[model samples]
Target: MPIKLHDFQQEVVNKFFKSGSLLCVLPTGTGKTVVALEIIRRLKEQYGNKTKCLIVVPANLRSNFVDTIRKFQLKLNAEIIQKVSQLDQAYRTKTILVISYDFMRLYALKLLRYKWTLIVADEVHYAKNRQTKNFAVLYQLRLNSRHFLGLTASPIANTPEEFFTILIIVTGDRSIFAEGMQLIKYMEIGRKDPTWWEKLKATLTGRRPRSKKGELIPIGIKDIEAFRRLVGRWVYIPHYSKIEKLGTRPKVKSFVVRVDLDDFETKAYKYALRKIPRQDLKDLKEGTITNARLRQIKNIIMACQQTLLSPDYIYEYEERGQEGVEQSNISLFRPGSKIKAVAKFLKQTGEKTIVFSSFLRFGARLANHYFNKLGIKSREYSGAVKPQERKEIIKQFEEGDLQVICLTGAGQEGMNLPSCKNVFFLNLPWHGEILRQVVGRALRITSKNPFVRMFWLFAYTKDGQETIDLWLSNLIKRKDIIRNAIFAALQETTANVSVQLPSYEGPRPKSKRKPDTVLGINYPR
Candidate 1:
C-alpha cells in the first residue's frame, strides 16, 4: 500500500511547495519524515531524477533515518555518508545524502564543490548557533542551495534574538529580526493597554483619534474588526472545590541513604568542585574525583591510610595503592537499602516498571542487583550498548521477557515501550524534552491502560525541587501554546466566513521590493 499523509503532514508539504524555504514545526510522532518525503517526491517528479537533496541530522539518529527511509520504500535513492571524501562518489548519482551535524564541519568544503538542488535540515534549531563551525557551513549551504527547508518540533527560544537567528536561516531574510522586534514591541504595548495601537498611530501620524462615530469610518477599524472576528477571543476561568469522594492512589515509596563521605570521597568531591565547577560534576562523580590532576595525589594518600576516616583530612602520603581508592568506594552498582524496597514492590504489585537514571553505570548496577539478588528479570539500554544489542533489549522488553527496563535518555527516543504503566525516574534528565520522551514510553495511544503513573525521585532539598519546577514550567508553557493555537484554529473554522475583493481586477503585479509589512513584525532594538 502507498504511504498515507495526515492532514498536518499535507499542510506542511503544501506550505513548503508554495514557499522556497519554510520552518515546519510539528509535534513529535506527527510523522515529519512523511512530510519531508512528500516534498522530495514532488521535487523529483517536477525537476526530474538529476535533482539532489541533502538531509542533516544528529549523529545518533543517522541509522534511524536510514531505517525509516528503507521501511517506507521511498523511490528516491538515499545514501548515509559520514566522511567528506565519500561525497565525491555519492554526488555522481541522483541520490539523497543523509549526514550527521558533526561531519558537516569536517567535509563542508569538499561537499560544497557539488551543487545541491535542495537541502533539508533536521533538528534545525541547532543550526542557529552562528559561532559553531557546522552552523557556518550550514549558513553557506543555505545561500548555495536552490531550495531550503528546516524541520523542528521545538522552535521556541528563550529570547527573541535566538528565535530571530532561526527565522533568518529558515527564511533567508535578515529583516525578519527587525520584523520580530516590531511584533514584540506591539505585543508589550497591547498587553499594557489593548487600545495602544490606535493611540500610537494617531500620535505618530498627527491624525485625529477616532471616536465612536468615526469607528464606522471603516479605514482603520475595518481591519481590526476583521482580525477580531477571525482570531476570536480566549479567556481563562479559575474554579476551586473540595473533593467529596476522595480516592485512594498507589504510593511510590522511596528511601534516601546517607552514604558518609570517606576521606578519599570527600577529597575527590572537593577537588572536583575546585578543579571544575560544582555544576559540571554529574551523578557519576558523586563520591569520586575523576579529574586527572587530582587522582594521583588522592590515590597516594588513600593507600597509606589503612582505615580511612569519615570526613577526614586528605593530605600527602607515600606508598599508596596503584589503583585509586575513590574509584572503589563510588559503587555505581550498590543496591543500597532502596533495592529491597523496589524489589518487594515489584513482586507484590506484579506491575511492569521502568527505571531511569542519568548515569548508565547506576542503571546497570540496579539492573544487575535486581537480577542477581532478587531474581527479577531486567535489562539495561544505554549509550554504551551496541546498536544491535540495544535493539535486542527493546525486543525483549516488548515481548515480556524483561519485567524492568532500565535505561538512560539515549534509549528513550523513538522507542515504543507500552508494557509498563509505572515509570520510575532513578535520576532526572536535564532537558524537559528528554523527560517527556522517557515518560512517553508508557503513553502509547493503542494501550488499554486507563492511566499511567510517573514517579520522579527527587532529593528532598531546595536545589532538586528548583530543577524539577523549572522543567515543569517549561512543559506547561509548551502544552499551553499548542492548546491555544489549536483552539484558535477551531474557533476560526466555526466562525462566519468573510472574503475581501481586490480594488483592482487586472492581473496581480509582482513587486521588486519586499512587502511593506509581514503578518508578524518586530521593531529592531
Candidate 2:
C-alpha cells in the first residue's frame, strides 16, 4: 500500500519547497515522521544513493527507524549505532545512521568527523539550550551540515528567540532567520482566515474554540461507530460508555499531593535561586536556556531537586540533616517531603509503583534512598542504564521481583506495564505533555487491574520560599481547554455524520475549567 497523506499533511509538505534546511512543525498523530520519510525519499532520488543521512532520536525510537526503512523498502543502508568504536565497522558506503541525543553529545567530536549529506533531529525542542551538550554538539555539527530537517510536535519555548534558536543550529547560518522572518511577515498564512477554515485551523493548531458550538444528541452505538469512521483513533475518548462495555476502558484517577520543603531543601533552593537570574529559572522550566551558564544552572537545579530526595553528598543541601535528626534514623541522612511522601504511599498501599523523576540522578537517588531503605526491591531507568539492563529491569518489575522502578524520560515511552497500576510523580512535571506521558505508563485500555491510580506530588504553598510552579499549574489548565476543544470539534464534525453512542455518560468527563491562556496567547476556550 502507498503512504497516504491527509489534506493538511500534503499541504504542509507541498509548501516545504525542499530547501537545504527545513523545520517541520506538526502535531502528534499528524504523521511528522511520515513527512520526514517522504522528504528522505525525494532527497535520495535526487541526491543519489551515495547521499548519507543521520537521524538522532530518543533512545527508545532507535528501532523505529530500522522498521520504517524495512517497511518502505528504502534502499539506503540504515544502521542504529551509538558506539564510537563500531562506526569504523560500518561500511564506508553512504548510509543513514540512527543515534540518540546523548550519544551525539558524548561522541560529538568523533561523529562530527564524518561528512554527512543530511541530518534530521526528532523531538527538536530538546535542542533549545545552547550551553547544554545537545545544543553545543548540534551547533558544531552544523558546520558540516548540508541538508537539515528538524521535527517536533510541540514548539515548547517561553520566547520566540528561544524557539527559533534551534533553527539557527539546524540552518548553520543565522542569516536565514532574517530571511525567514521577512518571509513570515509578508506571508498571508497568519492573517484572518474564513470562519469555517478558521474553526478547522483552530483544531489543527490545538486551539480551543471560544464556546461550545454544538449540542450533544442522544444516539445509539452505531452513531459512535460513524464518528469513529470519520475521525480515526479518537473514538475511545468520547464514546467512553460503549468502550467500557467492551472492557477497553482504562480507569485512571489522578491526585496532586501538596507537600512542603524541609528547611535544608529551602536553604539549598534559595541559594541556587539567588545565584541564577530569575528569568533563567522560568526558562529552564520551558526547556529553553538562552544563557550559556546552563551547566551551573543545571547543577543548581539538580541540587534543589536532589534536596527533595537524598543528594549523594549530605552537604549539598546543608552541612547536616534537620536540627535534631538522629544519626541512626534514615531521616538523618535523607529527609524531605518527596521521600516521606513516597515512603508513606508505599507503606500505605504496598502496591508496586513507578516513581518518575525529571532527572536521572534524582531517579537513582530516589530508588537507592527511599525504596531500598523501605526493604522494597527497586531499580532505576535512565540513559545511564544499559539497554539490556533496562529490559531486565522491566521483566523483573513485571514478575514482582522489583516493587518499584524509578524512571526518567528514557523509560517513559517504551514500557507497557499494564500490570503496574500505580504511578507516582515524586516531582512536579515540567509541562502538561509530560504529565500525560507519565500517567500513560500505567493507564491503558489493557490495564491488568480495573483501576489505575496516579499521585502527582507537588510542593506548592502560600509562602514564596519553598517552590513556585506556575508553569505546571498553567499547563494543566490547558488540558481542559483541549478537552473542550475536542468535545466541540466532535459535536460539529460528527453532526452530519450522525454518529454517537447510546447510553452514554451524563457528560464527557467534566473538568470545571474556565478559559485559560499561555504566554499571552488566548487558548480560545
Candidate 3:
C-alpha cells in the first residue's frame, strides 16, 4: 500500500520533484518527515534500488526520528547510526541512513564518496552556519548528492549570510548573495532611521533584508497564516483562578526573606564599577543602560551586587520613636510573584507542575530550594544530564513517580510530558519561537488533561513587563490573523458554488411578508 500524504506534505513533495534541490520551511507538526519519506519513495522509483538517501537530524532528536520511521513501516532500510565507525561496509546496503549532527564530521568523507541519490537534512536551519563542522560535511554531501532537500520548521537564520548558506547548500549557487544584498539595500533606503549598522552588515552578509513591503523581515520559512491558525487554537486555561473559584485552591504560601549582603556583594559591585573605564561612562548617552548593554559581565555582576545589598540600604519602613530601627526587613511573596507563587499554589492544590527556566543554574537552585529545603519532590533537566540519562529521567517523570520537574528549554521541542497540567515560565525565552515551543509541550491535545495553564513570571521591572506585554500582543495579533484567514477561506469556498437552474422559469416570488422588517430600529414606545 502507498503511504498517504497530508496537503502540506503533498505540496512539499511536489516542490521537491520540481526543484531537484529544494529547501522546505514548514511549521512544526506539519509532516516534514512525511514529505521526506515521499521524496525517498519517488527517488527509489526513479533510480530503483541503486539510490541511497541520507537524513541528518539534531543530535537530541536522532532517536525520535528513528522511532518515527519504524512506526511508519516504510520499505526503505533505515538505520540510526550515531558513530562513524558504525558506518562500515554492512551499513552501506541500507537505502536510508539517519545520522546525528555530531557524528556527521567523522563519516563525511566516506559518506561523500558514495552515490547518494538524495540528501535530506532535517532541522536544515543549522546548515546556515558554514563554520560548523557538520555544516561543512553536509555542504560537501550536497555536491555529491543528485538531489538535496533541506527541512526545517523555521530555516530563516538571524542574518542573510546564514540564509544564503542554506540556499547555497540547496542550489550550489553563490548568486543568492546578490539577490539578498539587493533586498537589504532596498530596505536600508526605504527606512527613515535604521536601528543598527549590523542591519546593513546583515544584508551584505545575508543576515537581514526587507520584505516587498519594505518592512524589516526576519528569516522564517513558515507560512504566517498557518502558524497563526495553529497558535489561535491553543487552549489557555487559567488553572490558578479556576481552582480558587472551586474553593480548593492551594494553601501553601511563599515568604520572600531578604538578606543583607555582608560586604561580599558590595565589594563585587565596586570592583565591577571600577572595571568600566571612566571614558566609556563619559561618552555614554542617557538611557543607554538597557538590558542589552547591561548584559556585559561587569554590569551584570554590579547589578547582582546592588540587588543583593538592597535590603541593607533600602528600608521598608522607619519608626518615629527609633529612627534607625526598621519596621520590616523582609517582604512576603505576593500572588504577583508568579514563579514562587505558582509553585506554592501547586503544592497547596496537590497538582504536578513543570517550571521552565532559561538558565540551568537558576533552575537547579530553584529545584533545590523546593526539594531539599521545602521537601517538595522536584527533579531538574539541564545541560548537565548525559543523553542516555536524560531519556531515563524523562521515563521517570512520565511514569508519575516525580511530582515536580524543573527543566530548562532542553526538553521543550521533542519530549512528551502530557502529565504536567501547569507550566510556569520562571524565566521567559528570548525568542518567540522558543516560547511557543515551550508552551506547546504542555498543550498537546492527546493529553488526558482538558486544558494547560501557562504562568509567565514577569518581574516588576520595566524590561520584564515589556517582554510579557510583547508576547501577549503578538499572540493576539496572530490569533486575529488566523481567525480572519479561516473565515476568508470558508467564504471563498461558499462563494464559488455554481447553481443550476430548473427548466421551468417562473416570476421571482416577491411577498415574504415585506421581508419581516429586515431592519430593526430603536422605536419609542
For all candidates in order, the CA lDDT equals: 0.49, 0.55, 0.50
Candidate 2 lDDT by residue in tens digits, 1-525: 335655545544554443456666543333456666776676677778667788888887777667766877766677888688777656365477888998888888888888777788887777876567887787777777677777764433232333446767766766543432221111011112213212332222111123233211111122333433333221111223322443543566555455666566665555545655676665544423322334456555555555555433336334554342223344345545666767666766667788888755444544546677778778878877898888788888887567788888777554657678677776655445565556656655456787666665556332533253333443333222323332334422222111111111111233578434322211212
TM-score of each: 0.59, 0.54, 0.62
lDDT of 3 by residue, 97-137 (tens): 88877778766777877778888888777777778886788
**Stretches > 4 Å off in candidate 3:** 185-339, 348-352, 368-375, 399-403, 418-420, 443-451, 461-525
lDDT of 1 by residue, 194-303 (tens): 34324532222212233321211001111333333322221111110101011111212222221223334444334423433342222112212222322334433222
Q: Name the weakest run of 10 consecutive residues (lDDT summed) in model 3.
A: 495-504
RMSD of 2: 13.2
> How high a TM-score does candidate 3 get?
0.62
Question: What C-alpha lDDT, on a 0 to 100 scale, does residue 507 get in candidate 3?
Answer: 20
Clashing pairs in 2: 223-499, 223-500, 224-500
Candidate ordering by TM-score (highest first): 3, 1, 2
Error of 2 at 189 (Å): 32
TM value for model 1 = 0.59
The residue ranges of model 1 lying beyond 4 angstroms of the native Cα positions read 157-162, 181-345, 349-353, 362-372, 418-420, 441-452, 459-525
